[model samples]
Structures are given as structure tokens and as C-alpha cells.
Target chain A: MSDVKTTALVWISPSTWPACVDAARERAPDDHVVLLHVGDDRIAAEAHRAYAGLLGRGHGPERDPGSRLEALSGVAGADLLEKAAHRLGRPCELLDRHGRPQEEVIRAAADADLLICARDGDPERPGPHSLGPESRFVVDHAPCPVLLVWPHRT
Target chain B: MNSLAAEIVSVGLLLGVLAFAVARPRGLPEAVAAIPAAGLVVVLGAVSPADAWEQTHTLLPVVGFLAAILVLAQLCDDDGLFDAAGDLVARFCGGRPVRLLGGVFGVAAVTTAVLSLDATVVLLTPVVFVTASRVGAHPRPHVYACTHLANSASLLLPVSNLTNLLAFTASGLTFTRFAVLMALPWLAAIAVEYVVLRRFFAADLAVGAHPPKEAEQRTVPTFTLVVLGLTLLAFAVTSLIGIEPLWAAFAGTAVLAARALRRRRTTLPALWRAASPLFCLFVLALGIVVKAVVDNGLDTGISRILPGGESLTTLLAIAAVAALLANLINNLPAILALLPVVAPAGPGPVLAALIGVNLGPNLTYVGSLATLLWRRVLHEHDSAPSLGQFTRLGLLTVPATLIASTVALWGTLQL
Candidate 1:
């Protein structure tokens, strides 16, 4: 049989990046790993709404705090992805995206053989409660197999 | 139509508008709900066109002030006044979380008192959050200070809050007098807020001992600060000179907008948008809707319930009722509904109601637009406080502030 290298996708978040990176390093050391971080725009949208609600609409893109915030988030997401890549210690593709985190993760995982992620909530419990809505959505709808791990050792 | 039908239609329309505003369903602008509801009230004969016109006339100055202040606040933000303030706070705090909290409190109180609570919530909250994070301090206490002071510290001046603007008009107190009268109550409320918040977030403030990595130096926007100071002084000067404070607000906005445009910091369209014509329209429409409700006898109902006296006990009762109404139906509408009834009693009850509507909103997110916006800011930072946590802190702070401020108002009126 011809040997084909497996490709793995790891979802990295501020709280769960360490655990996901560890899992990727341990289980898929020989595989091609893609580190993905999605910057959620909900905060920017909320900021726009707040500016409009009280201060009135029509704040141009330059003056809008939402735009600046989105820029900041982008910088932050890039930094996170860099950190994750460094921890992986092997050659990896770093992917930075902006949108709904779960949807972005799912879409990024379509071509991968396996997806690695960490449970984002209730780390002490081992039930549905351990996963947040985003993680739950990713695990259920991922195009590839998911390796869900706790954010920390339980 | 019949009196009963008019009352039902007016009340129903107002409630519908308020619900839309509070829920902001599907992220619709409040004007989308308020404008149509206002038109419906007029179309249904619940309010006459002439009555709507009169209400608009009465609200002209308040709306104008609001628009100018919004523009002014936007320009100040664009000029980096808030960012500079954040940098200053960070350096002043020297990486101590407790000191950062106090710095936030001082800046937030002064910002609210001078620039209005909208500025504090929209412009200052993010700045404070960024400052706390940059200084390696837990942001919870500092950011919480911003929202709490936006409400509690807004009791200081007529320009500080929309409710105060309305109450200022109704009370017939000069600009200086309004500030003088409210100063004591404002201080009391701020003191109570600081104490309660310090205690409530004690644990969060206890951590974060690391100093800033490299305290990025930002130059304070001296021009903007000077203009803001001059504008505040102009507020009192114009009030003393027998002109509406809107002119001062407009002049200040014009000066700042001109400077911003000249420096290419903002576009003309951005300046126009900053004036927030749509929001001003919302307030006018809301005023018309509220006027219809009052004319249909909401004022009479409130009058029957409100105690009639300037005594300390009576003032406390008025404040309590105002706080309850504010929490029940949002501060803007609550003040709109209560003002007519309270204004007829005298300046004492009107000021007391102002205290209640301003400080009372800290009790719930729905109680004020500022609180709702503050929540959005926190959510953006991924630090939104849970509803239970917010309510628990509110429970500790709101009543204490409300009562303390009301008592201070009573004492001020005596003096």
C-alpha cells in the first residue's frame, strides 16, 4: 500500500490552545498540522450597535471603535496562532480567520483527516456541559473526525 | 375616539416602542420602532397633530443639546482624548489593580459629569478596559467602575444625562443651580458605588501583580481637553446669559468638529453622522408618544400615587417610586412619565426623581440605554458579566446609592 501522510486541523482559542496543541503533538506528530484561530466579530458588531444606540448612527469606518476593535482582535488572533505554532514545535500551516468561530473551524476542517479541539467549559465535569455551544457545534458538524480533549487534565 | 380607547392606544403604543428599544429585536434601531409607534399614535387619534407639535417644541432644546453633545463626544474620541486618558490611568496606577480601579472611578465620574454618560459608556468603557489589560491588571473592577459611574456619577449636571436634561427643563432651575443642587447627591451616589464595587470585586482586584510590559507613552490631547473644559464653562455662562445651553453645546461641537476636519481626523459626513439626527428624531418621537400617554391620563394616575410634599420622607418616597418606575419601564420613559407629575409639585421632587432615574438604572441592564451599551462593550471584550453577577452587584449598590443620593438631595434643598 502506498503511504499517504494524514493532515490534522487543530482549533486554537485563548483558553484551549495549549491543550489542543499538546494533543496534536502527541497523537499526530508525523502528520501535517494546520493551526486555525477565528476572531469572532460579534464584539465588533456589538460595539457598532452600542455606538449607534446612544451616540447615533453614521460613524464612519475610520471613526468607528468597532473597526478598531476588529483590527485589535485580528492582531490578537495572529499572536495566538503564532504561539500555537511555536508550541507545536513542528512545521505547520497557520490559518487566521474572522467570523463565527465554530463555522470557521468546521469549514477549515473539511480537508483534514482529523480535527483536534478542547472542551471549553465545565472542565471538572465530563458531560454535555463540558462543551460550550461553539465546541458542541464543531464536534457535531465537523467534516472530519474530532479529537475532543479537556482544556486541562481533569 | 373615546377617552378609554385613547388611553389604551397611547399606553399600548408607548409600551410597544419601549419593548422594541429594550430588546432591539434583530438589531433594529430604536427609531425604527419609536418613529412608527409615534406616527401610529398620531394616526389613531390618540394624540392630535398640534399636541405632537407642542411636544416637539418643548423637546427642541433637549434634543439639540443631545445631538451636539454626541458630536462633541465623538470628536473628542477621534482626537484621542480617551486613549490618552487610558494611558494616563495605566501609568498612574503603576500596575496595581486597586489603584487602577480608583483611577477608573475618577476618570469615569469626571467624564460622565462633564461629557455625559453616553461618552462614559461608549468612549470611556473600552479605554478603561484596554488600560486595565495593558497594565496587567484584572479588567473586571476597572471596567465595572466605568459603567457604574456612568450612571451614578451622571447625577452631577444637566448635561450629564438625558433624564437630567428633561428634569432640568421641567424644574425651571438654571444651569448653575441644577449643578449646585445635584452636586451633593452626585458625590454621595459615587461614594456608595465605589465602596460597593470595591467590596464586590475584591477578589478580582486582588490578583494581577505584574507591571506593564512597556507602558506605551501617548500624548494627552491638550486641545481637546481644553475645548471640553471651555464648553463646560460655556454651558454655565450661556445659561447665565439667558440662552439655551444647546447653543453652547453646538458651539463646542462646531469648534471640535472644525478642528477634527481640518486635521483630517474625521470627514464631514462622519461629523454629520456624529450629530445623530436619527437619535434626536427618536427622542422627539418618544416625547410625542409620552405626551399622548400623559394627556390620556397617565400623569393623573402617577399624581394620585406620588406623595405631595417637600418633606424628607416625601422626597425619599418620590425617589423610591421613581427608581421602581425607572427599573420597570426604562429610565427615559420613566422620567418622561414621572416628570409632568413631579414638576407640578416643585423643584425638590423633580430633582429627587432625577436622582432615582439616574442611579436607579444601575439595578438592571434594561433600566438605561447606557447600561445596555456597556454590556455590549463588555461582550466585545469577552468579559460580559453574567446576569446573576450583575444583579448581585446592582443589589449591593443601587439601593444604597439611591437612598444616599435622595437623602443628600433632601439635605441640599434644606440648605
Candidate 2:
């Protein structure tokens, strides 16, 4: 039995991507990856995170920091991640981090052999890919070799 | 003085007046519209539309066309097409100012030439401004060059710039013929401009390098791609359909502006509100220009000042006049004010007036609307050149562009 752990962080709009994430799931150690969407310090310290913070104290998303995904982002991500895991004949678990995305993503990179990001959100998608600012940063400064997933434009 | 002399003098004086106005614009459009208004007042005053120039009546359609373009663009802006497109441009060029500047220059030149200056500016400025800020490139030079190049590049295609639009309205020029003739020199000017100016225009900071933590916190629905595709596709289709760029703009703006409207964003209506004011300004300036050209009389004075109206001497003389007028007053007004005077010089010198005036903006920022816009948005950073530095390039490039344009105009005449 192999005993290596890999973490993958995603901080992209799910609307533009559902396919690339599916591919990432098949490749991760657990047939799934630890998804961390860290946030900024201000928001991280707040009792409430996200737009809900505007609604006032004690009235925002009251979930633990390491669980649950944005309904929109989660559906897209979970569905895609599961699809890819199935393709690889592996099993995976979906996780979420609610801190600053870049910082969380960087932290994720420490444990990640591969960080998957959607390239400009191409829905049809290719294998796991990375695009945009977050993805670029991960690739350039990640702890390990970064496998950039790209959309099959052709 | 005779009515002709009076009209020419009026135009000349009006031009001098506008030169002052350029230094003090009551509004943004005022700076650009001054030349056109002065032309209208001068021309209409000198002679009746029928009596003055045979081509005057044909220009009437410009109002409908420009209005249509404005209204349509307003509606599409309502749709979010531009926002989407802008985001994509930003994302692609992201944080690199040098790439962004080059991209903007390329995009602006191509779009302005393809879609007409008025339409191109209306559509592109939002994104260009945002990207410019990220890279810390001043929006001034970008806007300025885009304006001038918008008009200048449009000359190659009758469909490209408003000047070409007006020229088309006022003359019998066709799209194909114009593009075929001016393509080479247009290519040269753009090449020179990019090479000479791109380095100086490099960004003040590394763009797109610092992705805000907001990507995860504030989910702005990944519509950047969708919106970009939709807007670009729509605009391209409209241009292809010959549906009149303005009408296409209105349709698209309607869709994009919907969200902004629903959000009660004052920004949306503010854009619409800009239309009437711009119209009024251009109308006022055009009226003044026409009055100056027709009623006050400045041509016979120009003619007397430079003899031999048809020879090579006249060609060179009018070219010099166009260049001088462009620098002294706004290029639009300079072109309009001198149009009547050059009527006797045949297509050759008439062509000279057109080309020289169009290319003359390179001489000074105030010389062209495009130049003015470029001057307005330049980012202040270590890399961005100061006005004096930019001017040094302009001094060299403007004359070179002018000389090249003169040669291009020379082709129109067998001489």
C-alpha cells in the first residue's frame, strides 16, 4: 500500500469550469484532494465571511473553516472531481478552506503535487488545468512540480 | 473684403479661438468638438448649403448615423458586453503594462479602423482604462493615441474612423478604394508608432502579479469569458452585416446594461446622460467652424498668401497649410476650415489636405482628439515618459508621419 498525501486547492468561479476539476480528482492520492480556499486576514478573522458579512454579526455562513464549498463552486467542483476520480478508478473527498484564496492556495501548494485551476473557465474543459492569477502563482511558486491542466481549445 | 474672404477670415479667427479653447475645455468633448463646430458656422455663413460646396448636402446623414451609433452603444453597455470583454482583455494581458500597452494600441487601431473611431472608443475605453490602471500606465497617452490613431487608422478603411465617415458622407469615397490606397502608409505609421513609443509607454508596475484575495471571498461569477465572447462576437457580426455599427452597439448595450440598471448603478445612466451633452458640444463646435469657414471669410486670404493654386507649388503649399492649421487649431476644424479653400486645387491637393490634417496630430498632443485622449490617461511611474520626453518622440515622429502622408497623398496626383 502507498502512503503519500497530496492536497489540491481551487479558488475559481465554478460557472466557467466543471470539466477540468473532474480530471484532477482521478490523479490525487485519495482519489480526492484537500480543497482549501483561504481568504484575506480581515475576512478570516471576522465571525462571518463573504458577502454575508454585510448582513451583520452572528448572521453569516456559520460553517467550520475546513468544510463546505460555495454551493455554486461546490456543485461544479464536486461533480467534476468525482467524474475524474471515477475515470481513474480512484476515490476522493472534497474539502473547502474559507480564508484568503491566494494564501490558502499557497498553503495547499505545500501539500499538493498538483493544484488544478480552470483556464478562463472553459466548461467543456480538458484534463485538469490552471489559468488566471491564482493558477499562475501556484505554478510559479508551488512546493512541487505543478501539472497545469488546460482546456482543449482544438 | 468679399464674402469669400470674410468666410475664410472667420474660419481662421474661429480656429484661433478654438486654439484657446483647447487649453480650457468646459467639458471633455468640448476639446474634440471645437473644430467641427467652427467649421459648420464658417461654412454655413459664407454661402448656403447649396451655394457653398456641392458636397455639403450629403453630409446630412452623419447625424442619423452618429446618433444611431451612440444610442445603440448605450443600449449594449446596458448589457455588460463591454465589461465582460474588458475583463478578458485584462485577464489575458493581466499585469504586464508593456504587453498591455502594445495590445491596447493594436486593439484600438484595429477596432477603430474596423468599427469607426466613435464606436471603437465607446466600446474599448472602459477596459483600456482598467488595464491601464493596473499596470500604472497613464490612461492619458493611451486615450490620446487611440483617439488620433482611431481617426488616422480609419482613413485606410472608409468604415474605420469618423473622419472617414464624414469624408464618405461629404464625398464619394468608398470603403474598398480607401483601404487599397492607404494601406501601406498606414502600416508604416503604425509600425513606427509602436516601435518608437511602446518602450516609453511601459507599465509603472508589474500588472496582474498581485491577484487580490478577493477571488475566493468575492465571487464575481466567472462570466468574464462568456461576456467577452458574446460582446466581441456581437460587435463583429454587426460590422459584418453592414447593420451600421451604432445600431449593433445599441442592441448589445441593451443586454450588458441590464444588470447595471437593475442594480440601480448610477454609472449606467451617467453614460446615457453623456450622449446629449456630447451632441450639443459637437453641434456647437461644428456650427462655429462652419460659421468661421463660410461667414467670416478666411480662404481668399490663404490663397493670396500662397499663389499658384494648381501647380506642384499649390500642392506643397496646401500641405504646409494643413499641417500648420492642424498644429495651431484642432485637426478636425483645420480640415473643415480648409476644405472650401482647397476646392479649386483638384483631388491632388484636396487629398493633401485630408492626409496632412489626419496625420498632423503627431506634431502635438492638442493637435488631434486622439492625441488629447492619449495625453489624458498616461500613468505616472518610473517607466512612463514625461510630457517633455513624449514630445521629443512626437517631434521626430510627427514630421516623419507627415512626410510619409504627404508622399501617400502625392500618389493621388500623377505629378
- Name the best candidate (by lDDT): 1
lDDT of 2 by residue, B248-340 (tens): 444544554565566774364565553444443453345444544643446666666655554555666676777777766556566666666
Give lDDT tens digits, candidate 2, residues A63-103: 21211222323343354444444543544444554434455
Estimate how well candidate 2 is docked, as a DockQ score: 0.02
lDDT of 1 by residue, B1-415 (tens): 8777898988888877766664555555678888988898899888899988888898998988888888888898999999988888887777567788888988999999988988887788778757765654544566667777888999998989988999999899999999999999999998998889877765445443345556478888998888898988998999898998888889888998888888899998887777777768888899989988988888888888888999998898889898888777677888988998899888999999998888877776355544464466556667542365556777999899989999999999998
Backbone clashes in candidate 1 total 0
TM for candidate 1 is 0.76
Best model per TM-score:
1
RMSD of 1: 7.3
Tell me candidate 1's fraction of native contacts, as a decimal between 0 and 1.
Answer: 0.06
Model 2 lDDT at residue B46: 51
Q: How close to the true structure is residue A122 of candidate 2, measured as C-alpha lDDT?
A: 24
Model 2 chain A weakest lDDT span, ten residues long:
A50-59
